[model samples]
Target: MTMDGKVALVTGGSRGLGMRMVTAFAALGADVIIASRKLENCEKLAQFVGEEYGRKALPVACNVSDWEQCDALVAAAYAEFGRVDVLVNNAGLSPLYPSLDQVGEGLWDKVIGINLKGPFRLSSLIGTRMAAGDGGSIINISSMAAIRPAPEHLPYAAAKAGLNALTEGLAQAFGPTVRVNGIQCGAFLTDISEAWTPEVVEVLTRDVALGRCGEPDEVVGAAVYFATEASSFATGATLRLDGGVR
Candidate 1:
């Protein structure tokens, strides 16, 4: 139990890569807090985590895009666990893959609000609590789109690039007490895959050196490592878990 007695809050923990991160933190002996927009979904996930890991799991409904909601989320987690040791800024959205010419302003704002602003708000709210405690780690889940421009996903790519910049900036600003890093994930088999067709998956797989898409668990390993003491010296870094796509 490398993270014994620690507390972790994972946004968007109801499903996908976020869910896997919640499980990983629980397995590492952290009392996990799973938050999302739906209360029922978080409650169900909390029950499962409690049963599987035999540790306290708290679930709270939160829309990370809202600053007030993020504040409430941090307050609830602190109430349950007394402190936040790890914060996984995983809540994000990639609505539709529209080319820059086809993208409307409304859709662009929505995507950026959820993908970039959400993490920024939650990190600020939770990072304060962490600073008060014994310091903590912040893992921002970014994407390869931040490095490689996805023309079809213009808004998403731009937002993720901003998130990458935020990760680095926060690491430097919150140093000596807190560590901030990011994971630039490639292709992972998650609900987001529904956006891709079979042809797209086939073409993308051919480009990956691993010859297949990454699993949710594979990405969770990096999240767990960053959350634990193993990455104590690591900060202002972006770990690429993209099946050697670069």
Candidate 2:
């Protein structure tokens, strides 16, 4: 799908899946706004996209967990591009804790804030603008844990489940124009996977139909689909990019 002349703003657009998406969109001819907590990482990706794809890239330092920062990101994006044709809520974190009982309030809040709250705030802000403007697409990068909750990642699962619900509700709220969808992803060998033990990796791979974790770029097709007219009639849908996780 060609996104020529369009603008895309992606949160967490520095490393992993977000990084891949930034480049993918740029390659398809969309100017990109890369937002992340680290200014240097975002700048590096922005420079790469500009130099490699010959597309404009704006780097904004933001921690999606904060409401004020989310507002600022939107302001910055609109100020730079005037409009955002695609918005990807890709920033998230699922930190490990010793046990459920040991999940302190700080940890719980941090996980929920980054994974759920941020998406809600960003979507609300940008979706409204998209609905009022020439229409656009909003994609949530969720996890399969949202549906198949595990004790080890209950908080993350809960947050992602909320994100799924938000996807559906927002589709209606911003309908008749702006489209909203979600990508429920399975295990991917991202930077996060570097922490997985050999046994953990084996267990993750053995049960999936694909027989292995996905590469970072594997999710690009789905992301591109939702971001463009390829999924023109698919708002409120949550596509499983999980390689048939079971």
Candidate 3:
């Protein structure tokens, strides 16, 4: 799918699935803006993308959870590329893990703020710009945990589930303009896996029909599909890329 004149903004694009999505977008001929909380990491990825693919890759520091930063990110993308044709809400956090009785307020808020509120805020900021332009596509990176809880990751699942609802709501609210959809990813190899042990990985993979964990590039396929004209007829839909785990 060619995105010749498209401009894509991928949050958390410093590494992992986010970075892979950025690469996919760039390969498809979209000028990409990679944003994350770390400026150095963003710059590194942007430089690599430019050198390897000959695509225009701009790096900007942004914490998606912050409203001002989200606005600044969209503004920077507009300034660099003249318009944003695709927005990938890929930044998220899953730090809070506790039983209902043991969950703390701080943990709850942090999880909700990053995983749910961040996408909402970013979509709001970018959706407005897309409306003013000729409209664009919004792809939210959700998790299979949103549909099936992992017990320990209660807060994360809840936030992601709520994010799915928000995606549908926004799709309807901005229909015939900005198309909104979510990708429910399964186990993927990323820095997040650093927290899991070999044993945990085995257990997780056993449940998947593929009997293996996925690579970040696998998720990129979905992002590319959702962002391009291929999915022009799709909206308010959650595409699952979980290797048959769900």
Candidate 4:
């Protein structure tokens, strides 16, 4: 119960790493706000946390790419939980394109909107509130794609790079009160792995010191550390969780 009485608001929290984070917060004695595009999925996880841990869980359907939805999601979380002690921006998208030249403007906007814009708006709104009262934490779920970006992942890599920058910017903006950080994750065998071919997986995993993609559960410890007193002296930092990709 390290986080007893705390409230954690996690975006893209319906599944994958996001769902893992949602479950972790509940186990730490924090009530959770699970948000994503699908309300039913959020609800299912919400009910499970409530039953398993006796923690209050709120389900919110939010398309982070939309400014209006991001605003509504924060309002909804505050309405239900009174305050958000931890905010995790975990939702993201990286659409596939045959070539860089084939990447349409529509797809580009979608990737940037979800990967960067939504977190910007959400953090500005909630982080300000957290800074002014009681203080809280902000965690941005970034990607290693920002560093060793591949051709097909240009837009996604660029967006995550912006996220890394935003992480530092928000840390400074909310400093002396709120702490902000990012988790620069590498390949994880989440639901999205179903889309990876054997060759693709091999190429992605070969250079890692661990020689394998990460598990969703492995991300929980860093997340909890950032959310609680364990990282009280930390902020404006992006921790790599890519299994020592070299």
Q: Write the per-residue lDDT of candidate 3 for residues 15-55, one digit (tens) a residue.
A: 99999999888888888999999999999999988998889
What does candidate 3 score on TM?
Answer: 0.95
Name the 10 consecutive residues with the lowest summed lDDT in model 3: 94-103
Estimate the lDDT of model 1.
0.87
How does candidate 4 score on lDDT? 0.95
TM-score of each: 0.95, 0.99, 0.95, 0.99
Report the Cα lDDT for residue 66, model 4: 99
lDDT, candidate 2, 1-246, per-residue tens:
899999999999999999999999999999999999999999999889989999999999999999999999999999998999999999999998989999999999999999999999999999999999999999999999999999999999999999999999999999979999999999998998898999998988887998889999998999999999989899999999988898
Q: Write the per-residue lDDT of candidate 4 for residues 39-114, one digit (tens) a residue.
A: 9999999999999999999999999999999999999988887899999999999998999888999999999999
Q: How good is model 1 by TM-score?
A: 0.95
**For each candidate, what is the lDDT?**
0.87, 0.96, 0.88, 0.95
On residues 123-192, what C-alpha lDDT tens digit does candidate 1 reach at each position? Answer: 8877776776679999999998888876777788899999999999888777788999999998899988
RMSD of each: 1.5, 0.6, 1.5, 0.8
Task: Kindly report which residue stretches of model 1 are placed more than 4 angstroms away from their true locations once superposed.
Answer: none
Reference-based lDDT, residue 238, model 1:
96
lDDT-best of 1 and 4 = 4
Instruction: TM-score winner between 2 and 3, please give it.
Output: 2
- Candidate 2, poorest ten consecutive residues by summed lDDT: 203-212
